[model samples]
Target: MSQSGIDLDRSLGYLLKEASSALRTAMEEVLRPLGMSVTHYSCLELLAQRPGLSNSELARGAFVTRQTMNVLLQALERDGYVTRPAEAPVGKVLPARLTPRGQQSLEQASAAVRAVEVRMLSGMTETERSAAFRILRSMIHSLRDGDGNDGA
Candidate 1:
């Protein structure tokens, strides 16, 4: 080991966190005008891609607690952006699906988010982007493995 103090500027974990915070801030800037939070957009986007996902499933996907996702789902349903059956089809798990209004809203949010991502990657070469993706995934796997969370 080098005989020196730890340099946060060169710390991978610190850099990762800084990048994550910056990404979230950028996402919020674009989503705020549409009156949507990142979690809200993630939930809607998940439903759009995989209709009939349960609240718990969505919570897991969005990295929020089930209670938080449940509250958001209720609001979305009340606002007619999503619909749930009067009763769960089975096992008390109500599946959520986006309505036409939700789809339209998602279209706008998706465009805004895509713009942010495009700007983020504008300085990267295709090879660098590919390597970054692989490196991040490996880091996630290593961390999750140590924590005994296989992510199912």
Candidate 2:
């Protein structure tokens, strides 16, 4: 190891960041022809899975701020992919849902994403892939429980 105070062999953060960057790049490439950024695609996917979610809820699911989500919602609406129904009777918030076009786009986008995922994991054996997934899930849970501190 170099004198960077971090052993490359034990630097999980570095490894995870590098891998995530690579995967994100690949996903961007795959989604480019569909006129969707990763953020937009993510929002569509979440909406498809949980229709009629509030904008705040969609933001949380997409790991973005409500303001950013509003921008995305505007773009989707312009593209005819999403819509907000009329406000509820008195005090309830109006929920957003995917349009039929949005649903179809999401289905196509999902297949593209899955293809990229499969290509990315092709180097790993099935057993290795399963173990890696389990370990990553554990790490995600740990980080969630640790109040966002990685303790690095």
**Which candidate comes out best when scored by TM-score?**
1
How many clashes show up per model? Answer: 0, 0
Clashing residue pairs found in predicted model 2? none
* Model 1, span 3-100: residue lDDT tens: 67768888899899999899989999999999899999999999999999999999999999999999999999999889999999999999999999
lDDT of each: 0.95, 0.88
Worst-scoring 10-residue span by lDDT in model 1: 1-10
Native-structure RMSD, model 1: 4.2
- The best candidate by lDDT is 1
- Candidate 1: which stretches are off by over 4 Å? 1-6, 146-152
Instruction: Give the per-residue lDDT of model 2 (tens digit) for 1-152.
Output: 77888987789898898888998899999899998888899999998888888888999998899999989998888889998866663457557789999999988889999999999899999999999999999998887776776667
Alpha-carbon runs more than 4 Å astray in model 2:
1-4, 88-92, 146-152
